[model samples]
Target chain A: MKNIPGDLKFLSSHEWARVESDGTITIGISDHAQDLLGDIVFVELPEVGQTLDAETDAAIVESVKAASDVYSPLSGEVMEVNSLLEDQPEIINTSPYEDGWFYKLTPSDLSELDNLLSPEDYSDVCED
Target chain B: MNKTPLYDAHIKLGAKMVNFSNWEMPISYSSLIEEHNAVRNAVGVFDVSHMSIFDFDGGDQVAFFEKIFANDVKKISKGNKAIYGALLNEKGGILDDLIIYNANDKFRLVSNCSTRNQNRQWFEKHAVEFGVKVIERSDMGILAIQGPEAMSKILAIKEIHAEANNLQSFGCMFDDDRLYAKTGYTGEDGLELIVPNMAINDLWDQALEVGCVPIGLGARDTLRLEAGLNLYGNDMTINNHPYESNLGWTIDMSDESRQFIGKDALLSIDQSKSQKIVGVILRDRGILRSGYEITHEQGKGEVLSGSFSPTLQSSIGLARVDQGYQENGKVFIRNKALNIEFVSPRFIRKVKMQP
Candidate 1:
């Protein structure tokens, strides 16, 4: 079974959002998502200060087999992006939940977090 | 979907199974890079049983092959040897690329699984007129052991070591119904063993016990791409001829007396004006993939097969471009034109891991 951290909220597309103490939302792909896209070789992250709408394409993750789009779970402004992934994209495969976070966002609407899936719900989604 | 004889073994090893040409085959066991590196630096085994095999016999066998196959079978007919070539239509378009093996009285042909039905139909349509009997051997399984240490690992197997000891490259040794050929698709020294379906599990187990890593189709694609080999469906198809597909060397035009199926059309076409396949290496950060548009000095073309080359630590691809296009070019990926370097279609030859 894949790990679905209780502290995080998820989109059905498999992006995880964690609300930071300062009202910022941290986003990354779920462990199940990384497992499906094996051996990620390239990661194209969104630029800082960019505005993103809810459920829009925010990033791209490429494996040897194919490329996939990483969707944004909520409308937000990109505050920070993962620079380490520019050189070491395989880190997403190794530390997807921790050091492999894609970006941090300052949310336009905090109420959108409630619309996301809970840990138990996300686990059920992964099972299916 | 169909399953190979080693399907249970692949499942037991936690392989990621995928559908490939109506067959449920393993796409990756652990990871694509690991499996690809294993084949480049060490020994790896592949369950290539999905490929189709056919046998030819009868008095008209030699004459029939001379009329159909692009390569000269008579050159390898005496000894137990093999030759790679293509089956073409009357317009010189490739029907399929295959390897033909001369096993003394009978000849063997190995072809892609995707074109199995079509190839059978084409063969049957012409076989009756030539008095040749074409028989499909669906009861057989093929295993390929490849890498720098492939020969040593295979020699450790006791069953047919003696027969395989003196086998040369492109040579074969038959022990009863089993065929051991010193040939492989990967650019490495290895053996392709054809055995009965019932005995495949035993052979696979022995190979695993002897330190051969089980490779899946994901790594198989990367390995073949790094070697600059062509995939049947991706690189060549019925609309392509030998010259455009970088397979001109496989055709034998020396024997004008032999009126092969595609000889007349091939002779009529001018080689200098045809588009050709070439290798391209990305100088940018992103990966190259198929269907990407390319703009060159002479003309425009598209990528045929592209992937992240694990061996080269860079992205490489095969692109079909106009004849005058050479050296450096630009490939458009997502509306951004990135610089690329063009080289010979083959990327590696007889590559071994450096100690």
Candidate 2:
């Protein structure tokens, strides 16, 4: 079974969002998503200040086999992007949940995280 | 989907499987880079049983093959030698790329699995006049043991070591029905063993016991790309000819007297108009993929196959560009023109394994 952090919420599409105490939310692909996309070589992160709608493409991760778009789980304005991924995209494969976080977003509404799947709900979705 | 004889073994070893040409095959086991490095630095095994094999025999077998394949069969009449060439249509467009092996009285052929049905129909249609019998041998499986220490692993098995060790590159030796050939798709010294279906699983187990880790199609593609090998469907299709696909050397044009299936059209086409296959390395921090536009000073082309080469630790690719492409070029990915360095179509040679 894949690791599903209890503190974070997930989208059915596999993005996970963790709300920071400062009201900003950190967004990254789930471990299940990174496992499916083996050996990520390139990542196209969204620019800071870019506005994104919920459940829309926010970034792209390219592996040798195929390229996949990372969806935004909540409507938000990008505050910070992961600049380390520019030279070392394989970090996503190593530490997908932590250091590999895609972007920091100031969510339009903090309650939007409630609409996403819980840890138990996301685990069931992965099994299906 | 069809499964190889070792499908269960792959599953047991935690391989990630995918559907390839209607066959459920392993695309990777541990990781693409690890498997690729294992083959380059040590030895690795690949299950290539999904490839289609055909056996042809008869008094007119040689004559039939000479007329069908672009490469000359007369050169391989001595037996136990394999020749790689293209099977083309009447218009000189590639139908498929195949390897033909002369096994004394009978000739053995292995071609792409995706084109199995079409290739069979093409062969049978042409075999009528020559009175040749084409038999599809799906009952056998193929395993490739490759890398620098590939022979060391095989030689450890005393039962077949003597014969396997003596075989020259592109040469084959048979022990009863099993054919072991010193040929491989990877740019390394190794063996491709063709064995009966029932015996394949046992052989795979033996190979694993001797420390040959299983590799998947993911690493297989990257390795072949780094080696500068051509993939049939991706690199060349029914719309491509040998001259443009960096396969002109395989065509037999020395003797116009010996007519082959696509010789006339191959000769009639203007070679000057065809784009040449060249290798390119990305100088920028981006990935180059197939169907990407490549623009040079003279004209534009398309990338046939591209990948992040594990050995070189950079993005590399093969592109078909106009004849005017020189040693320096650029490819347009995501509307950004990135500078590229041109190298030989072949990227890697056999890596020297440290003793």
Candidate closest to the true structure, highest lDDT: 1
lDDT of residue B321 for candidate 1:
88
Measured against the native two-chain assembly using Cα atoms, what DockQ does each of the candidate structures obtain, in the order listed? 0.93, 0.80
lDDT of 2 by residue, B141-220 (tens): 99999998999998875555477887777887677778888888778888989889998888888888888989999999
- For model 1, how does the per-residue alpha-carbon lDDT over A18-83 read when each residue is reduced to its tens digit? 988998999999888888999999999999999998889999999999999999988999999999
Number of clashing pairs per prediction, in order: 0, 0
Chain A TM-score, structure 1: 0.97
Winning model by DockQ: 1
The estimated TM-scores of all candidates read: 0.97, 0.96
Top candidate by TM-score? 1
TM-score of 1: 0.97
Candidate 2, chain A: TM-score against the reference: 0.95
